[model samples]
Target: MDMSERELHETFLPPFKATVDEGVASFMTAFNDLNGVPCTGNQYLFKEILRDRWGFGGMVVTDYTAIMEMVAHGFAKDLKHAAELAIDAGIDMDMISEAFVTHLKELVEEGDVSEEQIDVAVSRILEMKFLLGLFDDPFRYFDAERQQEVVMNPEHLKTAREAAQRSIVLLKNEGNVLPLDKNTSKRVALIGPFVKERESLNGEWAIKGDRNKSVTLLEGLEEKYDGSRVEFTYAQGTTLPLIDRSTQKVSVTEVPDRRGFAEAVNVARNSDVIMVAMGENYHWSGEAASRTDITLPGNQRELLKELKKTGKPIVLVLFNGRPLDLSWEEENVDAIVEAWYPGMMSGHAVADILSGDYNPSAKLVMTFPRNVGQIPIFYNMKNTGRPFDAEHPADYRSSYIDSPNTPLFPFGYGLSYTTFEYANAKISSDKFQSGSSLTASVEVTNTGDLDGEEVVQLYLRDRVGSVVRPVKELKGFEKIHLKAGETKTVEFSIDEEMLKMYNIDMEWVAEPGEFDLWIATSSADESNHLEFSLVE
Candidate 1:
């Protein structure tokens, strides 16, 4: 599960790893109401899960619409009882369910709930209210408080800006026309309908965000230096595809026209460099979005080829959520930047990188395969009887014919403004006892024009096992900073359990055998392996 607030509480770890209090906490039978209603009106969910396992002593908020939905869950006598049971159960806030704000204290005085409990809940809520500055000033966050000033703060801009550049996947850089020297080209063409819109800029589930004020790529370029000298033209290559029927009760903005694609190609005809923006909209791939095909939308695939026909240096900025099928763009475009909805003002973030205000260091979080056929492929998984081998053909092995066994872009792949070299790997002890520790060390050097950082990864592979282990497991990793020509040694200490494998019965065990320890820059990169033996 992701590191969300809710997940930080509900999802329990396997019992073998549970803490002392967690071990003591046991699941109980589903209970009905104290008399005739459901136990949701009961005070246990908050008293235990909140106060005990989670240590969430602050306050408990009813899930949205929960107090109102209590009549349906059949826990309360009415909205009144639902509100009463909730507050008595230590629920502190009513989030849109509205009833708790209406019927809490009356039930408390009726002796249904102890006044102390009400005070506890009220004190908790009021404390947060005070911390929010709601009680002290009530209007502090809104009144001349610089909401946009902070939202679009220089630091946030820098992060979004740096992230956009790093997440860019340089699929093909044929001529090296990139790192575009402003002196080299006076005129450039920024083409694409998405050059302005941000429906997909921050992707889906972006909380409390808007696009009307988002700085578009064109706007970013114009805002940068010498806007008067840099001759630039823009065209709508093609409109983002639509479903033909309005879904929003208040209709959303209309998509532009696709016929503009040919005109966009014409605009790029004589420019020194061409920057083409391509990809899906905000509603395209987050949350409920499940695409049957993850490819560039509309005629943009064909549009890329036409841009190539112009013979100008081309840089493609691709915006998408999941791994896209980019074989065509990878083949034709000079460079492809995979900008995954880089948040508000994502366009300005792009301009920051293109202008070389920041360096790229974002590694890919998921594998970008050549196509959709290789779906659900990830780095951390179990080893199969016969892992998919492309060189040596196999019938029963897990593989596909039309596609290669490997991802087009493997995991932990990212490029920086500089380069790094890895060497001199060593383990504290070539021999590690079952209960002892093993230290893996590697020296890394940054050999480039500018200072940069690299996330050196350490992986372990169990050669022969009672239960098969994956080809590699990321046992440890470290992010190190290095000067342009400096080197540093990184070491990872491995305890017995970190090197252990789970058996068929899910028992943690480490059998005496040859284990290969790897220290590499990335998962697919060549790693110097040292053989270590774990004794019984």
Candidate 2:
């Protein structure tokens, strides 16, 4: 209505679009703030923004306990007001938000809301329940026989192992120390408090995940190791870091008190090659788990440093949710594997990778910093009016003085035993009309002795926008495989939507101008840049 309040209008709409493209038609709203406002009864999420703009006619379900939390959110006058606002806003059903079922009918009778709206919402909720086949037998999912039959099926275990292997980012390897020979490791030492613990393997949000059923790294090694030839030794070393909270009363388990840190250091001295399984316990990540100090907790850091002085080759295996401070390990450790809580099959996966049965191809999704002060470091950065160039640091550029503005281990950083090279990238056109498609091709060659896979990432920068754009945007990506000494030509189609930049009015438009296409190995720029145009 007014230009002065134009920015406020955009706020009335859903700031982030729900992932409707994922083929999930049912209601799946997060319980918390979506763009700084509660999402449970958010009108922007259901009626005006979702259905009107995104065409999402799917069920709008309440977040867990959100229908009730509205009293705390202060949006509703009472339980009845909460139900009416949510239902009138197009919320069809409630998931653990009991206010809807309790007051929906009463509101309809009083004419505060209508039965037609209630029925409409209830119908969509039932439709999803029908799709899930829950109506046939609501208790079928809880059947113990069915749970036993499907739980950790052989195929699921295999998948868990594969996912584990894929998630293990080899952070550091010096002098070709990884992929150890199974025949050579006659006496192996798995010295860590986590090696036998079951609770740490199953990460947070893991509903119904059996901790007792999990095979720890020590257990996995003992089960696989040839008893006649191979010997296994495990020390109850320091406890790893658990989640840190500034407000909550913290219970720090005395890692050094559990076992003498000196004893563990001595154990490392005698082992053939030390495999130090370290990092945070499961409570450190996921919901409500933010961190101030992202480093090896307890006495683990001191233990590692002391163990390094023993002149024994060390392999570091880290289990964490987000990236951590690993500058010393990256520089010192002979080998490092970033296994983000590999689930029930974590132990077997580590053994497989160590025994050279599986070749890892996991890449870093977030940045690892030198310290906590350099946190929130990710792949994407905004181009300031003055950007930094190392060659010309004195040009009043965009950078930090004390520490480099870059991350220690960048986004898309990963390792395999093999190596790959990219060449011969070509784009089909310099210009594209609205709703048209553009093709970009490239040749990827695996130069190492082992076969592996690489994820080809495509990024775009919308220059001359009515609004500001990130330095680079992850428009498209594809994973490809290559054989040793083999080269394959890969192509990705660039849709017109890739060129659409959000205007000051929040309208997506492909303005007529030159657009730059960046074909890279990761989210960050890897090799070369290609230019193209988007015509009217």
Candidate 3:
């Protein structure tokens, strides 16, 4: 993708800058080209910014066959040219690409590449190897006995369960339908593709995990409720279309076969509540899994629509790697849970949340769009010249005629069993000089019946800037727990450092301007904001 220099530095480079600041020892080059130059052969990125400006003394490795891919990017003529370009661009190691090993020596001999460049690359790799003590004990990390002993130990499993519990985001809970009543709801019907599936729970990146050991949603529910008190039934209402990477073929159409629809509907009819486990199969997401449509794949949506006809409360649990088009699910489903590939303890963790054993405290880091049309939707976006006004609906505004400009669920949004009320938001001062700091605080009180955790978010916006700024930027956030009826004060120290950005002249500085601040629940929250100014 062609990107402006300003966009590159402001939008893309900040995270890399943070890694450099944290003294990261290794870096991987991307496969894509930036501004016509392949990342593996991008001299400006490697030499100018990474090495000279940031002083990153790390070994740079090419992503698998990325050096050779530079030829496909048209940045290099051949394998030899690619190797020469990579080494000159400060690349140290080649991952699964024989381009360097096959052509580097010949290129160096022909004077197309220098001995100094090769020496520098070798030294960086050697430095990392030495740091890792690989030279001291070559097979130190390959102990099969120790691996088996620690792989899925009790403590590790407990930690995994806790982590999975915290990672579950409660996207919707209409009529307080969630925290499913195990005691009251006698018959629980687990329906959809993921009801008993275990392999996909480990997700795409888990190469060595034993799928048999992983817990399914069916298994978790059964373990959670007593057989005498609560009876759990399951139905595979739909099957996810099989994605064959080798053949690049899908087993089913977008609206898959409806053979299991009848059985699934029957099961739901006999149940008190229907827990539909659905989402992209593990292979449908993660690396190399790009899609133009990101709705519920195959027959899942059809199955859900059928289940809705049963007049039972449906709790939709989503297992996805990315944000999805959840507009239909949000409006129709009684409750929605984002259970993103919760690993081996997926079932147990989900059961914990559903049974109210654990009040889910996880907030969404990514925004969920209403549809795939809003592919690049985000919380922190610049307000266009003609921003959409909900009060004054105009055709000329920057919005779709088909859909609203807002997301299905905004960033930093999640539900708790309990509710928290924000009050008494105040700042230390209305104005502050550069280099000085100010304090912003707010009081959060648990206003619901159950004790739960809430993520108090702090967002800021520059009223005016040298360049346009995001309407709202998340500056700070704190996840705090409060007992029912308890109150706590959350304070955030704001300084010039938090306000720094690349100005019009491309210099990193905090421009003197009026700023708006909010201490609220989510990025979409615009209630009771305070205004402040930075003096020159």
* Best-fitting candidate, scored by TM-score: 3
**Per-model TM values vs. the true structure:** 0.75, 0.89, 0.97
Clashing pairs in 3: none
After superposing all C-alphas onto the true structure, candidate 3 shows an RMSD in angstroms of 1.5
Compose the digit string of candidate 2's lDDT tens values, residues 268-334: 7777788888877787778777778777767777777877888888888887788888877877878
lDDT of 1 at 406: 76
- Better-scoring candidate (TM-score), 1 or 3: 3
Candidate 1, backbone clash total? 4
- In the range 1-536, model 3's lDDT, one tens digit per residue, is 99878889888999999999999999999988898899999899999999999999989999999998888888889888899899889999999879988998898789889899989999999999999999998887898998988989999999999999999999988888788767673787888889888889989899888988999998888888865367788888878887876666564344458998998899999998889999888888888888888888886888888899999999999998899988888899999999999999999999999999999999999998999988789998999999999989888889998999899999999999999999999999999999999999999999999999999999999989999999988989999999999999999999999998888999989999899999989988888599899998
* lDDT (Cα, 0-100) at 194 in candidate 3: 90
Candidate 1 versus the native: TM-score?
0.75
Candidate 3: C-alpha lDDT: 0.90
Stretches of model 1 off by over 4 angstroms after superposition:
1-94, 97-142, 145-172, 198-200, 225-231, 243-245, 248-258, 311-313, 462-469, 500-514
